[model samples]
Target: MNMLNVSSNAFMIAFFLYCGAFIVHAIAVMGRKFSNREPEAHVKKWGRFGLILTLIGLGSQLVYFFTRWAGSGHIPVSNMYEFMTFLSMMVIVAFAILYMIYKTSLLGLFALPITIILMAYAAVFPQEVQPLVPSLKSIWLNIHVTLAALGESFFAVGFAAGLMYLLRTVKFDSSAKVDKRQQKWLEFTLVVIIIVIGFIGTVFAFRASGYEAVFVQQQVTDVDTGGTNDSKIEKVIYHMPPLVAPHNSDTESYTSFLGMKEPLFEAPSWMNGVNAGRKLNTVLWSVISGLLLYGVLRLIIRKPLSRALSPYLADIDPDDLDEISYRAIAIGFPIFTLGALIFAMIWAEIAWGRFWGWDPKEVWALITWLYYSAYLHLRLSKGWQGRNSAWLAVLGFLIVMFTLVGVNLIIAGLHSYAGTE
Candidate 1:
């Protein structure tokens, strides 16, 4: 069989393995009857085993992705199927990173199963190879998409950790109850993971693929002063024209217009005469600013601020979880900015001859970016720490998730790459 078929099969097997691992992890969480002492050595062994299995499953997934990339001859992110696969792999990688810091295998017990569901959803989409269009052939495509995926993956981890933080903070009856809460945390983590994954997966798999190219042609008569009616032909352009391959006969026209004809809708007033490249650079700088903000936070944490501050600030060190979540967002916010805003704008400029058109997807992306920016600002300026900041982290992720998936499926717009129809 060819590489895509082989990769698809491998992904299917990995999906099942993830499901089985999720189940075993759940059982381990449920079987814990007491938390009076550290979990029994055997229970720890089981947890370790589950984590190892999850890692193996994730490794297999990576192989499948690389093989598919080799077969497809482009980054596996042009369409919904490939993008969903990328998102799933990203979630696993993010979870692994968090596990390294906290050494909490419990998170993966939940995260892996959620990853499985996403891969399963991805399976339903068409995995057929589609050549990369001229517009997608850019170095920016690699930098913009890969970084965005990495940043979003970290946000995914923050979301899981935030949920766990919420669960951990809530008051429980006994240590056993806390153990039960941990199990609940596992379940909640899985749900959040799936929700984020499913949102992206469903849009690409079902909605983006289903988008239809619509065209309308009209004939009108132009009024003439000399009592003559001049017949005029007008083409009501609504959707982007079909992309032509570089080596194809139509390559001249395709390259001349930069791979697309015109906007489906009239350019919005706000976007009139704006420089697309400048807008892209602005968004890139915003992402860099976010990263710098995270660095400042890290530096602050490294110093002994407790000596200069009040007793309360000293007592509650907002250094550990808060810093981690902040750094994750700082790094991710820019990537999200690049993918959902910058590259998207570049695509819009090429396809529609304008950028920042306030399409539903575009609007939601701005909203997502602003929401996280607020989270960082509030956390830093207002001293929003621990649970409060973590909750905001969770909300920020939800907004990003909506921008990634919900906007494409629930709202109609020019960005239809996520649909399967």
Candidate 2:
């Protein structure tokens, strides 16, 4: 097989390996209650097995990265699929390093699933190798993207550790106002994560069923030389049924879903984005599917998810969890500053002749940086630790994610080129 084929096969292998590792880690954490098994020994033995599997998966993914780079004749970080996969790989690297340091099975229980979700999310985007656009042709593309993703990966690990700390410590049945509020917000955070997983599931379901819809939007542009408007028609395609149609557009083709042949609503005239309507429809479906999934899980568990999982983590030390979360973010923060801000500005100067344009993506990146900066300040100087620090770590990752995904979907700017078509 060709290197590209080899890369694809290797990627699949890595994904399966990661999945296996997650399952084994789950067993390691949860199987302690089984008959005749000492909890500590069971955890250590199975955690070692899980760690071995994870390392092998990481190695296989590295092969996928290099082979794809070889086959594509450029770095594979040019598009969403490649970048997300690379980010997932880096997350595994970070997780493994933390695992070695802490030797905590609970960390793997959270981290491996996240890595799996990222890999799956990457699959939701187009994976075909595409040539680098003019702006992405610099060596800084390699430096900026890899470093940014690497830093983000450490943040991901921080998020996992922080979340673990919360789950281990949060009082699910508390009657106090402070405790109740934390419960509600933690539940909301879990719901949001489920919603993301729902998005992946919804996309894959319709895509597998061969569902299709198409719209043609006519956009009028102002001309500088001529005293007239120039009209351009853009064709937008959806892999799922549309609940929201594009503004000022006619349906070129559409498939009925649940007896609905037309869009439920039109996108607002002001909502001019790259496939804004389709994206909005996707958001709607994700919310619906995610809620449904959460509901199903709730039914199965018959308790708050936090409560259901908290017992497994009872043996874990909350202070250690807090320390892991803080250390990961502390390591990630400076790297993020260097990559997402410093190298990014240098790249922008070279490509756009300006260092900072206040573009939506750039603005959000700045927002993320400032948010994390505040997080560190509060953590070190203002004495924010334990629950407060965990909350910041969790929320900080959310901001990072919004900067990565939400801005690309909702806003139109110079960085829109980085988004999927």
Candidate 3:
């Protein structure tokens, strides 16, 4: 078999192995409900099985990593699909090491599902390997992005712990007596969930329907020292249906969408680059599609996801969970700063002539960095202990995610390679 196919098979195997591990870990944590005295020895045996499967999954994915490098002649993290898979693999590896230190199956219970979710989310993107663009052909592509993704995987683990802490601690005053703070936190969490579900659902829908839209635009370049080319037609292909049609489609194949007016507001020149308003179109499509999906899911589920998970957590120690949540951010903060900010700056200076541009991606990276730094600072202080620190950790990851995923979808910039699938 060719390297790509072999790598694909390896990824699939790893997915199944991770799923098996998640199920076993979940059972080990909640099996006490099933038996009066679920033997600690039995749970430990099952945990070992889960750990073994996790290691096997890691090994299988390592094969994919090597074969993908051989196939692509570069690291697999040059695009969203590859970077996501690699990022999830890194999370699993980090969790493995942390598990060795903490020796807690509870961490696996919360974290393994994230790896599976990431793998699923990555599958929704364009998986085809392609030649790297001129901008992405630098060695920094591997070094900067590899470190950034690894660092964020730790943040992902922190998110798990943070979420666990909130679920264990946060409670509404009552149905009759609702504390606004608790209500707001719950609402914020649900909105984030909706966005994730919405994005994933829209991607799946487009892929299944084979829906494709093309954006035609004009291009200008300095030809013959001062001449420009406006005659060239740039065709931008989008698998998702357009919710907001672009006004610049010179081609007759243009299909107006959603009763949107002839011309919507235009993005800044830096946003869509040469493709005109395609980035704005994508952002609109994703937002509208996500809202619809979120509404439908809310109607069907009728409860926040945390409520469903709270029962299983009863046996898990709240203090331990809180500590893990704190420890995760504490561990992830320096690593993230080094990779996402420092290495990023060094690479940017090499590639783009400047170390900082306040590009959406760069700004968001800085925001993520500052937020986590504050999280660490507050954590070390006297007052912000359990709930506050957990909230900050969760919020920190949200910004990291926005830096990682949202900026790519909503804004265009030099740092798009890691995300612009």
Across residues 45-115, which tens digit of lDDT does each residue of candidate 3 receive?
A: 78888899999999999999999899878889888889889989989977887788888787888788789
Give me the runs in candidate 3 sitting further than 4 Å from their true place.
Answer: 134-139, 173-180, 215-233, 248-302, 418-421
Models ranked on TM-score = 2, 3, 1
Clashes of 2: 0
lDDT of 2: 0.90
Question: Model 1, 290-372: lDDT tens per residue?
Answer: 44543454477663222111221222223454666666676677777787678867867866688778888678777877888
Candidate 3 Cα RMSD (Å): 4.1
Ranking by lDDT: 2, 3, 1
Task: State residue 112's C-alpha deviation in candidate 1, in Å.
Answer: 2.4
How many clashing residue pairs are found in candidate 3?
Answer: 0
Give per-residue CA lDDT, model 2, range 343-391, as digits (tens).
9999999999999999998999899889989999998999999999999
lDDT of the structure predicted as candidate 1: 0.59
- Candidate 2 to truth, TM: 0.96
